[model samples]
Target chain A: MTTDDLIARLTGELKPVPRTAVLRRVAIGLGSSLAASATLMYFWLGMRPDLMTAMETTPFWAKFVYTLSLAIAGAWALKRIAHPLGSIRINLALMGALIVAIGILGFMQLAMAPPEAHYYLLTGHSVSICTLNIVVLSLPLLAGAFWILSGLAPTRLTVAGAAAGLASGAIASLVYSFHCTESGMPFIAIWYTLGVLVPGLIGAIAGRYVLRW
Target chain B: MNPVEARLKELMLASLDGDAKSYGVLLNDLARHLRFYFMRRLADAHKGDADDLVQETLMALHTRRATYEVDRPFTAWLHAIARYKLIDHFRRNRIRATVPLDDAQELFAQDQSDAAADRMDVERLLQSVPAKSRDLIYRTKIEGQSIAEVAQSTGLSEASVKVGVHRGIKAIAAKLKGGADDDR
Candidate 1:
């Protein structure tokens, strides 16, 4: 074969990568995050033995209103920063906003605590606080990692990132379960939401660099 | 028995006898024959898919050899596998046959034989290119892919893909032009 022929033949070869796998990974991340949130909410309800009574009171209603406002704002920030299309600026911005939102939420919880406090509210055996923190902190980190990793065009990087995020989340969730035996269902829903969010964010940031495929 | 069939049978036997390395050598040689088989019909010689099909077939053979019946003629089974792998490759890559049934007979009988000549030329060229160059060539041209896509798919640095693609193209071009130019 002559050089020109070889060049022409070589010029025509192209590799095919499958798109379906990337989409599946993203779907899994979203489902996992939603489940973590539900668990946190379950434990939250158990923490405040008097939460139902407080719900009937003015202060309880006020805190509820405040928390609801924070929730909406957090959701908005999440959408803006984690734009579905995925740009670096949008991602970093999203992470920064989420951290701020979580900080505010932690402070608000302390503020809403009653002085006469149910032993559960103060040094509580309640699973509510722990679940809430874990869920809140972990979701973003793990979710971000999985979403970003799977999108990279390189099969190896995508596979590696996916495996790491999935394994870590599984491990972390097990560890959290042992620590939050007292969390109310609602607490678990909220705190676990935060926990996952943190790891998800870390994963996302790391994926941007590693999976540049 | 045909010489090719006898060779393939020998290759299979060697593979089954625990000479795993011989299987690869057999597949490499078999790929050349497969290329010739497809070249008779493929119009675009550079449509690197023939090679892809050959590789896919070899993979299927390796993975599913245990199912092969010793009592059956080896050529029949090998040809069936080759045909199946070719179809599988098309399905996976979304390639379609443009000639409908109404046009098929006419196209087969009256079509220009240009594609066959080009396919032969391409096969010769491909067989001579270095392995690395061949891979890059296959990724860029036959796959009809962008450099970024190729890099992403292959997990190579973008710089490496760029350099490799350029070098590979130059080398193939040089080889095709014969020994006349040392410009590369």
Candidate 2:
């Protein structure tokens, strides 16, 4: 009816909302989706057989750090963009630095290795299916992030979508790492990054249509 | 931040704590500001839509209150939501160009013929709704009467009055959509 009447109704029904409501929702969305992704990974692609041995290796830890850092950056960006007028520049910068650092590490590894091993480092054993798996695993996480975003205020739909996509991709990569035996920095820099980007691209496009209030 | 922003932020913080009175005051202040904000961007011919937009934005602010971060500048968050609602309104109306606030004077200079025509069309559409619901919608929406007032006058419960007004609006909207589809 009238603005005054609407305001009256709104105030009348007002309840004390928890200060951490948004954070809680984000956590729930991420936690459940992560569990779902992990479950899917365990069923579809069992963990690496040399689980005890891989834990003590440098390359394995490198892959873990790279994916984990990216996931954190994506999450930071997503949280920021979930608010109205929230800026993602810092988050983007952090993510960019992480990628460059990984790239540098991969380059050094390639350079030190013999030229004949260059192809092996880059392609690893699963180049054909690595990116595909990451993309597929990201679907559940992407859905969860979108669900969380739909309930919040995000002014820049495309950007917010991209953040959600990036976060989902990174987190998916982390989950996929458990099953992946490839320890090459070059493989992770090339294929893992692509897997993350594919979902980010999908998120940007789908967000424009789905993230509307 | 300005004193106004500080005060609004304080009120919002209180409102989040379930202080209804403070919340009401905050909403009233916001409504005044939003009226001026929407009135400026809208063309003169479509000024009647300004209040509708204001109402829509207020509703969004209410539903998405949890998204407001306590540490962030309150005005920036409010402005973003307001601008988003305005953009959505423009897109729905297929309004490609907007009158800048600087040229708001030009808005008053334009004729009201289009608005008058729109009112007539709305009156025609209102006829399709049932008489009881139509009366409720008219009293509450056009007359700007409170739901409680309407309910008391009509001997109907407030909930029923609310439902009647809601149904009436939905019926009119459905008819308008049908008309647009026929034109297409």
Candidate 3:
């Protein structure tokens, strides 16, 4: 068939698309996955035992803010990348700055503490399983992001995937924090960040194939 | 934004509002723009692929129309999609930009010959088609041969020749429509 024929067929079935359709899909995708991840975490690890006291502590809030901020930044970047010709440089830069700031905070805390406590601060109690838990938690969100993106127009598939992964990973870390008892800035900076990066890397690699549409 | 960009953006917004006439006009306008855009960038040997690319890009645009943000520049979005289609075409066909030393002078030649280009395009289009259907299409469509003549020439029945042409066109159309679904 000719191009004009194709255009005619396309225009023949016109329907008004809601202005908020894309955002709504994004919200549904991430929100539902987040709910699932939370449920999974609740059943798997349960909340930290000293939940009330932890809520009052600065370190808990610090970890909360760091992961939440990263999640927001990732979502911001994902929104931009969902559109054609959208750039994620600003979002990436902001994420980098957030990580760096957290890293410095961790270093400062380490410097103030005596040398004997350095290992404890860095390793925490669950260093072996912390990153793995966060990654597992992010799986649902990552799948949801990929599903949403495949239906959208993301020109840079790799970057779009990475953004989706980053956002999902950050949110996973946020959920994991509730159950994690570690209060060290250094542990959160190192292990939590690694958890987020693993998903980011997975997204970047898988996106090239999954985000083709 | 320039006047053209402003006008196209207006039409696109209208199209998004279920205005079929506006959407048709916008697509018609985009088809011409994309044709020129692809033709200028494609190599001489692959010029025939421009129409296919144009159709594929338009299909992509139609399927992904919801991704267009009303506040952003429409032209920029269009350009990005167009560039992506071109890149995808190059990757699929493995078309290199290298010019043979003997044919270097052809790069500067300004001959606007249509027949030769059309033949080249027909050849490129048939490259991936199955050999039997490819030959049938080449003979009946490109060489202006009758179905009976192609059948006799290839020792196949006339019914098969007709079926071959029909299936070949359908295959090409299906290839163009691949991955153009909304998937929602």
Candidate 4:
């Protein structure tokens, strides 16, 4: 159908978004996700005195570092919040940074000492399992993705969100390629797509309530 | 314009004058108009960017509405909003600049399947030539406005319009052929 037909069909209910409200709503979303991530880590790895005591002995700082990094990054991103730039320059710029970081991490993996029994804090049966731990460790960055998608700009529908998600998924897969082993690409692609899809959905749904302006 | 279209136009015009009824009308009109706009685009697209474009346009219209002069033709204002929104669409989808760590082809080729996406690309090649020249084609071909109307409208000699159209057509034809080859 044509745009005219589409308009004719649903002409009575649309509302213009207010810019201030959208910004406020996005801030809330970011704040909530930050709280949730912290809460999750606290329960999973931090709250228990016994766990913390054991963790101090374990000498493995992966989970703690990852969680701490997430909180720090969230604070850093929140500090930079300002007016929405209608241009996609910022989105493209962030995508570039993600790409570079992925490459740097990839090179680090290749240059490092050969296989240790455990890739991170967790033990995995294979590279795919190890990759999952790495993915989990990237939560702070994933939260950043949420912030970007939510705060960037509104799209036409869920489709735009989906497209953005896929673009992100693809770009992320590219970055992951440089740091991850050859065996990890396909699984990374699939899981990364899933990871990106969630934000796209949130953005699209919230676009109705938050990003209209 | 039908009732809804007429109503929207009136509401837009009235809203300019600070009529509260018009504001509601505008929102209703927008909500109604956007759903179909997004839906149709989505229907044609292999990817659902049509939806994203819709919300973005709606959001932009909301953000940028203050810049619109209530005195101008509302249609012109509406079309302008559409054009800017389209510009944003291109910016989002275009090749992102990055530090080239990998082959350009590899970075682009992998994980992308936009070839499967079918968004209408209305690149009317004839539009690029010139409106003065296009007048000839419109008169003789599209509009059937005779040579006399073409001359009067453009303030050019009829003979000149005819000659320009002929030259324009030849150039366009060659360009299309080249474009076709490039596509292959």
TM-score of chain A of each: 0.36, 0.97, 0.97, 0.38
- Most DockQ-accurate candidate: 2
Q: B53-146, model 1: which lDDT tens digit per residue?
A: 5555555555445434454555566565565444444545566744222211221222234567787877778777788767888878887888
Which pairs of residues have clashing backbones in candidate 2? Answer: none
Q: Which ten residues in a row have the lowest lDDT in candidate 2 chain A?
A: A78-87
| Separate DockQ for every predicted complex | 0.02, 0.59, 0.56, 0.05
List clashing residue pairs in candidate 3: none
Candidate 3, residue A99: lDDT: 95
Q: Which is the leading candidate under TM-score?
A: 2
Candidate 2, position A56, lDDT? 100
lDDT of 3 by residue, B52-88 (tens): 9889988988888898998887877787777777776
Among these predicted structures, which one has the highest lDDT?
2
Ranked by lDDT, the better of candidates 3 and 4 is 3
lDDT agreement with native, every candidate: 0.49, 0.89, 0.87, 0.44
Ranking by TM-score: 2, 3, 4, 1
Candidate 1 lDDT, A144-212, residue by residue in tens:
544534342222332244333433333344334433443322343344444444454454456544543
DockQ of 4: 0.05
Model 1 chain B: weakest 10-residue lDDT segment is B99-108
For A173-200, candidate 4 gives per-residue lDDT tens digits of: 3233223332322232234434433443
Scored by lDDT, model 4 comes in at: 0.44
